[model samples]
Target: MPNAELPQAKRQKMANKTIGTHNGTFHCDEALATFVLKQTDEYSDADVVRSRDPAVLDTCDIVVDVGAVYDAEKKRFDHHQRGFTDVHYGLEIIAKRLGTALDDPKVQYVWLKLYRDFIEAIDAIDNGISQYDSDVPARYRSRTDLSSRVATLNPRWNEPTGAQILDARFQDASALTGKEFFQALDYYRDSWLPAADLVKDLITSSKQSADPSGRILVFEQFAPWKEHLFEIEADENVPSVEPNQAIYVLYPDEAGGNWRVQAVPVSPSSFESRKSLPEAWRGIRDDELSKLTGIDGCIFVHASGFIGGNKTKEGALSMAKKALEL
Candidate 1:
């Protein structure tokens, strides 16, 4: 009674559903798309078939990154076809049909959010869409993103083009893309989203508790605040929160065991601070900083005047308050 002798019904039940993609030179978009589809119950045990043959692809229940068809109802997801858009129409359909809670911070929500950051890049690359405007300086161009990395995994021009060789390379590409996708998904769900809530709460509280200027935010604990700060301020839903009021933030520095007063940037990613510390304190440290600032436990201020440190929370708060007056 070997396993081969099992009944046809039992064998069919145990067999994996088929997922089809192009055979040669796989890119990040398809590799990640396949992995994403596999995560769902409908394709949890899917067997990936890498081929360009119409006959082979037709047998697969779902096809992605190939076949030149963009029909969601027909289970086709190719962006190479003319008139194909970057929207994840198939995913949106699945989300709606399943009644996924868009409000909840779950996998579906994370998936949708991540599409903007990760999948959109792949779609843009596959569709030859430039991320930045055409007028952007050549020096400012970004090189070697996830798509480029995945493209590199394909067999080099000199490498053998045999079926086995191509298959092996495709497997390698799939694994690399899958790993990155899972890591990014977990990071957004576990770290980025939670930190955002905390940052928003701090921003609201700061507005209420700060002096009339409403410029300084005091954090109960240090966290990644830059991006969240800008997002919370610009959020249209929070009508009471003024987008331009915050100029500085105070938090504890874990490594140095000191408190820090940091200038908020004009924009989330900008290097220019909204309001710098006093020019006299720039690059000054310890005793010199204390004497100039007339504040005890003063550590040092950065040469750029973006940040300064103090031995106590009170000292850091004082530094920000004094800088505000200056």
Candidate 2:
């Protein structure tokens, strides 16, 4: 069993800090900010104060989303003021003060990475920035999200916005935001970061084992490779790694007990693959696919030729090897 006393020290340290944000109504940004602060060692156990009173806010060790000030040294992180941009401004200040280099991959990973996965939506909503431009056509619109949920938590129109009511609603808002914040943080820390190493190793090993062209990669197990593949291919600083020669990847399909050969996209976000399956094979399947490709156990090739499958590992490898020749 784990030691019961383990969190006592952390709790004691957290008890000394205070987080202040505005009272009455709440938004996703402040709620998320509160949650992110509590996850850090400096404010894990900090008392949360929801009040707009300047005197109350003045007593807080940190203020977020409510304060007009954007001072990092003073620990005020609000983006509402004129000339204020993204949350990165304040985070960059904190990062520098902590002696983390601006150029460090880990630092860049935290700031730039979380922007997409976690922070960007909050920033966009808070700043009134529309994700899509005005000219973009929309078939439907939706409002079920952190911001809408937080807005719902506020007192109904008939209900009074008293201190007790506001505080209760604030608690609910913080819980919603905190849950998502911790989930995203843990996902990045536990899953995404570790996968980078596995991907790099695969890339290196694949290059070594491939034919002299170094264009094909064979994976023993299926993994999320697109993002890591793009990162590795573009990374020029790595000593032994060559840039962007891979054209396809071969792996096993988990659900069907078959094997897959997928084309490598030029970039992670791009739909255009570097080298798709042969044109003759597209949208063909089963015995016809087998006869056309001269490969046994053939399954199907996607209409776009980006992917194809086979009933055996050897068949998939054969398909990929043949595609390479095309």
Candidate 3:
């Protein structure tokens, strides 16, 4: 058989397509990152890399910056729509857009590559030289007596947060280091929320092996939604799925303690693809989502289905089949 039997990652298109994805380097919350991981590969990464560099969002197809949904001062997701901006919720709307784009498989896989860049960036930064210095404030505000009469507004200066702000006035962190640190902020944005490559590798690797029976499939870390124990509480009816549709599955993660799934978004690099998901995912996208929701976040396989060595394609598939039995 032609290499057509290969995984999406090893596909000719994946090799042929060489999109330069941006790195992850912005402030985001866990909800946004968690939301992206469970989605399709292509869409998930597009959103992630953008989290690093949001300027790309406008160029992205599956995900778009529709604007804010809540207010921080108001302390709510939607402060009566009487809001200015809720950075948290604004990102979420964009995340939803990525999920909606799965209707096309081509778009989904393309977005997968973008998501890989995001994951790599996050891993790099989280492990980089940046430190949580308890010596300075994440930012600061001060006013200098520049004029008279109607005192002009003092420009607020921004910088990283750290513990230094608590003491050492002589050092003047602003002049000395010209920076600060925000551990809470960075942790939420990079390490927790963004999509990572490990997830994508699982999806891509599992597709290359043989399945003569075609009755089984392997997923690195898909969240099965159809068998959700709490799904009944949320929605009782289990929707019928398309045969060509890919299955979404969930696994136990030290990061996400609860059930969840991630998807990809559309971006300039992946905008062209909006066709089908991968074969392991049923090779059906675009208009295939309506029936595929049930697979959104389910860990259907039993413990017995799990096989170690997930690094290998065959090994990952073994675990996927084991997950199915659960």
Candidate 4:
């Protein structure tokens, strides 16, 4: 079946948060108003009152913009949202990542979004995807709307292997270079941040080579839970809240010596970040860590990078460490 049309409210809701209201100081309610106000630079206070119209968002700088920046002085739009997917998935990943660790109770809500571009892309390749599903066979196939013989694509998903399984679900990704297919993969990947190097960094840092200069110097950047929305899922099996972002300092005993991971603790104060993206990260963690940063824990994995929103503290830190060996 073709993609269903989205209701105006859904579209408006998306625009208000990402695109910003055309004009606004007061939004719909406490949550929405606060959300919009925070997006605007001067109107940081949610209680502050002003206009409430998408048009009034004119004062909003380029940050809240989904498209080109409206240069009032130039009277021309410069710099567009540019693929738009980046911001949509970027924020979504952060939100969902925290969602995985909702048990903390400190985080009220967690959400994720993909812009219209992704919807359009998926539609473009419906035929090819359907054909691939019909032609190929695997351990399992997902059912579509409880239909007959609808092989599930998301059956008992495996961690990083999900991507590889998805690629094989249809045709050879190498031969099928369709924009739709690629967009789907991008969406899939963005949902979870890669956890490759974080393992390497932690493992190597754990080593003590006896060289002071070669030792790891541990530094951590933490943020408060206020600005962030952590989500802890309720699993009859296991329930937990995950950290949205983190940074670890692997300081060895001696300088320049291969510093072992002497200690790994979550920073107490999780501060909001000032970056080019929507999600806020711990200052020290985001700055120092690379795309490979992630942590696995006893009950969850507390990954700093993306892992389809956020991996649990257990899933993030510990599970990710295990994945490094692969």
Among the numbered candidates, top TM-score falls to: 2
Error of 1 at 211 (Å): 4.4
Q: TM-score of every model?
A: 0.83, 0.84, 0.20, 0.18
Model 3 ranges off by over 4 Å: 1-181, 188-190, 193-195, 210-326
Residues 126-148 of candidate 4: C-alpha lDDT, one tens digit per residue: 21235244545776754432111
In model 4, what is the error at residue 158, expressed in angstroms? 40
The regions of model 4 sitting more than 4 angstroms off are: 1-19, 22-55, 59-198, 201-326
Candidate 2 similarity to native, TM-score: 0.84
- Candidate 2 backbone clash number: 0
Cα lDDT of model 1 by residue, 33-87, tens digit: 8877776778878888999999999999899989989887888888788757546
Better of 3 and 4 by lDDT: 3
lDDT of each: 0.80, 0.80, 0.31, 0.29
How do the residues 1-326 of candidate 3 rate in per-residue lDDT, one tens digit apiece?
56878887667444441111222221122223323332334433432222224354333333322223343443223212445222333233323444434355323433333334333333333234233557677575433311110111111246443323212221232122111112322332343323333433333443454333323333335433222222222332323222323332323343544322221112223322222123233333222321332333333322222111222343334434543454
Off by over 4 Å in 1: 1-16, 89-109, 131-144, 204-213
TM-score of model number 4: 0.18
Position 105, candidate 2: lDDT: 65
TM-score of 1: 0.83
Error of 2 at 269 (Å): 2.6
